[model samples]
Target: MTTDRADDRNVAVVTPWYPNPQQEWAGAFVQAMVEATAPGCDEVTVYHNEAWLMRQAPEEVEAAREAHRRLLPVALHDAPTVAGARLMRLPVPTVPDYTFAELAQQHASWLRESLGGEPIPARVVHAHVGLRGGWTALENARPDARVFVTEHASFIDKVLEQPDSRDMYEQVLDRCTGFFAVTDVLRDRLAETFPALAHKIELISNPISFEAPRPRPVTELRRWLYVGTLVERKGVGWLLEAFAECHAGDPELTLTIAGPGVLAGALAKRAAELHVDHVVTFTGEVAPDEATRLMREHDLLVHPARWETFGVSIIEAVAAGMPVLVTRCGGPERTLAGIEDAVGEMIDVEENSESIVAGYHRLRDRFPDGLDLAKGRRVLDERFGYRTVAQAHYRHWFSGPEAGEGAASGGEEA
Candidate 1:
């Protein structure tokens, strides 16, 4: 990265969750945007506030606080580099279930920490997610600098349910320069709930580019794959029953459930009870790179997620040209609408066992020889690849007054 191209196009990206050594996969896509845009823009400063304390048990809070006290960066030398971007960890705010005002105050302190009493030279302060990060950007962004937010939280449904959070979120939207959404479904959902801010909302989906490292082999197992956590909401239990339904049709078929969660033991037990234990393999929490490789190595991706804002794994598989089976979990339908069915498929999330089993049968019957995944890679890259999305984001960042021209007015589900 020559500083020449980015002369003064400094951007400060703030997020409440980011990937760290302890939580390797947390908010990784946000880091991807930071790295890709850094070369095109002058400089990128990431102020990441890891709020893992909220997930800790009540008795473990003090111990977890001590661990973070040892980890949070208070100076630039101690700042870490992730995916070619400089990252500084800010102290986490108080849990918002109790109070939103205190959360905003903590974020105000974090913005001051970024400046060290100096004026920020950022051309734009972009925040990912809502509330605290959004509040920080809204308060500290230079008057001339732009304030943009890219929201990806699934908890927006709950946020809307609360009077205080909903009102605060509306205030956050009203004051910001622009808002970005990952999926059209979410963009529509936001527009529906906050009609006043609907015109300010825009669509800029997440980035994904697959580079095959090795020649992936075609195995004879006729495998069915699931890449998300083994959680109840993810419907991994439904996946087991669905796979069991498919297993009876083809004895040669096998299932691989990657990624770990609290339901791992129960899922394994259910597989045994289905008498398909010998056919099911449990891979606890595969890393992103390894997960990408697994997508190519396997015959198909069976995603039975009950809920998703946007399914990254689906694009990953489709980008690799692998066949996919997804459920209508808010975003999958919109995602698959762009891809060819020979390369992917979807089922009704409500009728999981029957629909997924039928979906598998459809994959087997239709793609008897499996899909030519590499065939669709070029098109997928042109649309959702990192470089393309980053360039689009860069244009929006620097567009200034012209930015809101194409912003969605009716919040069309585009």
Candidate 2:
């Protein structure tokens, strides 16, 4: 994957969020995008600018910084290469008090220092997340490089709340050669914040693979699965309660909660208190491939999320031939647009268990006869399959005579 000559067609990916030992699900979408687009490029390298938060006593702050300075020199090449792309994880250590703009600046500083203050070698750079990766890439990429940014942050509202961060975000949009959002929800949010730059943001989907369908379309909906962080905002608490109610009615029912989060311990304890711990399995932080495997092993995807920018997991579940019982959260509403009934049931977002319970019942009642899993799969694959998204990237990244300079004419599909 290494080459002596830096081809003008080489691509560099920069991002603050990436799958790591501490958080395996952190940036799986970015990884998927890289995996999709790498084959067409002469070279691809991922610079995972991991912003590691530091909590230290005031007296030991300087010592912690010194330790980080020593550790970072050797840590750059420690990440495992993914999808034939060379991986470099540059850990940017910082105190917890920095604002979003400041944190982004810190990532840029670490990236610059790691590269010995040199520009990224690639002529084209694709960055995930508008603030951290986008800003960092803009600051560190070669002057002639065309930097494209994709916005997928769930807490974009919070980021825009701070004036400094919002101003910096505007600069990112203004400077980047192209900008995309994974869903209309995120695109509209950014557009609303900066009405003048609305024309710059366009819709692009995260790629999903449908090469391996489930062994068989699920005949029954007894096996329930939830793949996401176990946190209140994700509606995991409500999922547990709803699962308990469902299990009580059907003793054979089972639930598997995958991925890690702050509420893991509490959720397990609550499951025990509900007396359904026997059937509940908590798989903490599975790798992306394992998460896909889990989708195949189960019959249903129960995503009780309060919000999502794109709902990649839901789309993945459908790709794996599993019916989804998801909420009408921001992203799912758009992602599952016309194919809602064919794929699964969509419940209104709520804090209690009632909506999920009702949705599950509705999905079970519809089962095999009332759904067209094949049709749903076909529609989603046409929009988000690896080949489709990869080609879109190529058209945008290498369209013009100079390559990556034809951002204005990039595909404008919704």
- Candidates in order, TM-scores: namely 0.84, 0.94
261-336: candidate 2 lDDT, tens digit per residue: 9999999999999999999999999999999999999989999899888889999999999999999889998999
lDDT of 1 at 296: 72
* CA shift of 238, model 2, Å: 0.9
What is candidate 1's lDDT per residue for 217-317, written digit by digit as tens? 44433877888777788877888998888788788888888887899999889889999999999988766677777877887788888889988888887
- Clash pairs, candidate 2, are none
The TM-score of candidate 1 is: 0.84
Per-model lDDT:
0.72, 0.88
